[model samples]
Target: MHDVEAPPQERTRFQWWHHSHPTFAGITGFFAGMLFVTALPGAFVGVLRLLFSHDTAEQLFPFVLLALALPIFMLVKRKTRRFAQFMFVGMLVTALVVLGVTSLVLYFMVDA
Candidate 1:
């Protein structure tokens, strides 16, 4: 009887990308998007206050966002680069849209 050889298994194209760059890029993008939508503006205001007037609650949001985004950004930035930027922008836009929709809903609910 002739000996039979087993067929080789094919590897997935995305396996390496997922383990390598794409993973970090996706994460950084998420945090960047969250920072932009939730905390960036507030941080800017907070810094302005430090530069000019007394501190206020408005500044806290930005600082919070920065604290949250920095470490996340650093971890992924070196890996994904442009992919992270795309993710951040897309997420930020989505967040703004949701905020607007929520505000509209609240306004109608209050009026009724």
Candidate 2:
């Protein structure tokens, strides 16, 4: 057996990656909200694509409307501080839930 020097400082850094916590949370929430919003259109298109044998309005409408709605919703919400706060909190929670559900589905699908 050979003697080895233990690096306690290095081990301490490895114990917790401080940089990733807030970044991961931000990224997770960002992508989750984006995915949730994007999927609304995707679901519509998937259905229409299946039914019509051709992609048309459904392929485009939901995404287009969602894109348009963001600005409109913001503008309307701006009329009241309370409403804006409520909308923001609502969207944040929704994003977290969407991320959670997406992760669960992916976990099971991958495991299976």
Candidate 3:
């Protein structure tokens, strides 16, 4: 007599997404960085307003500079360096666009 029952298969392990494709990783990181650049200052200010007086919040505003260390840390690590590079480029480009638009608006408002 032969054994007819089949052995049970092993369950697959959970895998997290890392955006393995270069283009996908780059685009995801870039947009995420752009959003971070635009939203962080406002979010910080809002939180400060909620937690402290106007003068205190204004004085503490520069603390936002500390956030820069995150990307710098990401850059220092080989694992996240590629994504960080794209993120940095996105942040710079977004900042430039924001500054350019703001300056143009200020100039036109002053002229008018």
- In candidate 2, what are the lDDT values of residues 1-112, reduced to their tens digit? 9988669988787665553454444454455455545575677777667766564754555554555466346547544333334444545677678799999999999999
Residue-level lDDT for 70 in candidate 3: 92
What shift in Å separates residue 18 of candidate 3 from its native position after superposition? Answer: 5.9
lDDT ranking from best candidate downward: 3, 1, 2
Instruction: Compose the digit string of candidate 3's lDDT tens values, residues 11-109.
Output: 223223436767766897798789779899899999999999999999999999899999899999998888889889899999999999999999999
Candidate 2 Cα misplacement greater than 4 A, ranges? 1-54, 62-79
Model 2 poorest 10 in a row by lDDT: 78-87
Give me the displacement of residue 38 in model 1, in angstroms.
Answer: 1.7
RMSD, candidate 2, Å: 17.4
lDDT of 1 at 112: 100
Better model by lDDT, 1 or 2?
Answer: 1
Clashes of each: 1, 0, 0
The model with the greater TM-score, 2 or 3, is 3
**Which prediction has more favorable lDDT, 2 or 3?**
3
Best by TM-score: 3
TM-score ranking from best candidate downward: 3, 1, 2
Q: Candidates' lDDT values, in order? A: 0.64, 0.58, 0.87
**Model 1: residues >4 Å from true position, as ranges?**
1-19, 54-81
Residue 71 C-alpha lDDT in model 3:
87
